[model samples]
Target: MSLEKIKTVTLADVSINNKGEYGIGASAVDYSDELYTYLRITDINDDGTLNKNDLKSVDDVDAKNYLLNENDVVFARTGNSTGKAYYYDKMDGELVYAGFLIKFSLDSSKINPKFMKYYVLSKDYKGWVNSMCTGSTRPNINAKMYGNMELILPPREQQDFLVNILGEIDNKIEINKMINKNLEKTLITIFNSWFINFENYDNSKGMKIDDSYGEIPVDWSVEMLEDYVDFVTGVEPGSKNYHEKPEPNDIPFLRVGDLGSRDNGVFIDPSLSKNKILKYDDIVLSLDATIGIVKMGLEGAYSTGMRKLVIKNDNINQPFLYCLVKSNRIQRIIETFATGTTILHAGKSIKHMNFVLSDKKTMDDFGKIGNPIISIILTNLKEIEYLTNLRDTLLPKLMSGEIDVSEVNCDLELKYNYMKYLFNQIHTPMSKSVV
Candidate 1:
């Protein structure tokens, strides 16, 4: 690959306002919920998508000038995350891009937008961007600096071919995501009907029953959470003795952040022994900063941080219990129990707090419904992981002309059709009576 053949494209040439200043001034208007979504630096995902949760709304006219459109790529032009980019594909209305971000669009005639997105996210580009970043305290990149960076430009046809191949894989990943979302909605619906709304049986008159907690359904019984399970806190191994090579190869260790955004959970650096490991189907809950965010460990050994509550599943269906702990009511209970002055934190003794526990039959029934949804969620997650790996593996190879696309005849169109069929088939009603 000849570095000389690759053309240097500047960020300014492709941006809506190439000469715009780095940060928005104080005159920038406040955002409103009823109006446009405001995109901040935090809203940009590492993988080139917008994080909807971080979006706010702004009504200012000056801020609206930096508004994003479909196909616009917003880059974190300033701050510690400089050069991180997001390709905006969807927006309800006009969105204001925070001053910390640089907004640009690809010249589609010369470059494939999707290809350019992945290229910027590649290690080579990020390394270059990192090196070019200037500032002693808060590093930042200007449009001029970004525009001078060179990139490999495969012919338009080859660019399209590569983009199409990777795009197909991404399409499958989205399909899997949608499937997982539908599965979650189904589980949530079931939970709300059975527990929250009490739609499982007739309750037209808002009936009540007596139990340990006092008022409850006559058919339902309450038991303390401590009666069914024991909660254990996580211990940090400390950064001093943390070894990367030898330890990570053996036992899996988890951190508070390892609980993935969409998936079940992730392992941190692993240790040597597998014996002192957190196994599959164990319920792990966050106990600090952001409390009570619960997830089940699907694989690997994990660290039991002081902020983590490791629930020992003693015949209680782990999935069902996880759902219960993640419920709105339980979250309220956790919020009330949390203690702090500035940032409220979940207390260390939250595990000792007692809550009404449903009977074994009820828990098991809920488990039956939940387990399938969990299985589907995990399966879709694994599939996305696999697709991501495949795409990453092929990206550089295809771009560098090492792997010729002509030689490979994988039927991406057929795969996409099959993916759509599978997605629709998964949530189909089992019977007409059920619907």
Candidate 2:
């Protein structure tokens, strides 16, 4: 925890260069196996992680010049995303960063790149960024300003210890995220087959009928969403009432922003928050600003920009309703209803939207299968929240040296040796195959 031996140096002293190389100009080409991965500012999440699925590709011509390497850090230097950074690792593959981003390659002998990444998340770094970005219409941090920023560098050993512990926590969170993503993809495929395409239905038993919307099975019918589900807009407690840190009994205040972000939104005092409490499988739709974007409930009070969909009738399954609202068809319908040129709203139009509905028995059948998947997804989300909180809790303490993690390396070594011993004891080899 001692700062007596620490060195204070400008970013340029520890990095390979003061300014990052500009990325390739123009839009990314279509995704092709032959093309290199093209990384943009939008592809990097607020948490500094890359969204692999949303990435595009660029032609190989001069693309190698922009290719990122392990330990390289890319910073968003322009627009609303000024000062945002993304650290490249071995797993990110061959990727080229965009022009708006400035890459800072650290001198490993002087400072650990991973540790520098975490430092950027610290209050001091954020404060420095804010100070440099004052009173500008378009906020931008040029390469020279970035390189001139001062940083407090600890000894190599201390930096390694902090990075190892934080990296382990990050790896676990990413694992859970991947699991939830796969589960969602699987659930949607099942829903599409049974409900949308009617792939599993027996045509011999199903009779075709004509309706105003389209042809449908005689057993199926169409209904306005409001007929079976109650839609309630979220509340907006002024910023004064919001709590920066969560209270013991307070619930998280969900906003349209927190829909898919890793970090949960700010917490609100339960006593003061008048918004309807969301539950598992409840549908949440972004009705203001970013219209038509939908999310499933994670048990929080939503913000004014969102609407919570609650099932008023037992015949409609909650999971089905969630999928229905999240579908492209519903999104399109909601978009058509959206009003306003600058800030769109969908509350009025969404109320009267109609969708083809299956019979109660069919819904029940889908629920039997989809509910378990939804339950697992919700469980994963809860785990992610717990891990995220744990990491957040550890971050400041570790950064400030309030907690001495000097012994963490020793503890990890002992734990790993014990695990290896257990594996050797339990995993004995069979002399012959039973088959």
Each prediction's Cα lDDT score? 0.60, 0.74
> Relative to the unseen true structure, what is the Cα RMSD of model 2?
8.0
Best by TM-score: 2
Model 2: per-residue Cα lDDT over 302-361, one tens digit each: 788988887887777877887788777888888888889988888887666887788778
After the best TM-score superposition of candidate 2, give how far the Cα of residue 336 lies from its true spot, in angstroms. Answer: 2.6
Q: Where does candidate 2 stray beyond 4 Å?
A: 17-19, 25-35, 52-61, 212-215, 238-251, 260-272, 297-299, 408-435
Please provide, for model 1 over 342-381, each residue's C-alpha lDDT reduced to its tens digit, 9 standing for 90 to 100. Answer: 6556754455455545556766788887887787777676
Q: Which stretches of candidate 1 lie over 4 Å from their true place?
A: 1-8, 11-33, 91-94, 133-135, 202-215, 241-252, 260-276, 306-315, 341-344, 347-349, 352-354, 406-435
Displacement of residue 332 (Cα, Å) in model 1 is: 1.9
Q: With candidate 1 superimposed using the best TM-score fit, by how many Å does residue 238's alpha carbon deviate from the native?
A: 2.3
Give the root-mean-square deviation of each candidate in angstroms.
Answer: 7.2, 8.0
How many pairs of residues collide in each model?
A: 11, 0
Candidate 1 whole-model C-alpha lDDT, 0 to 1: 0.60
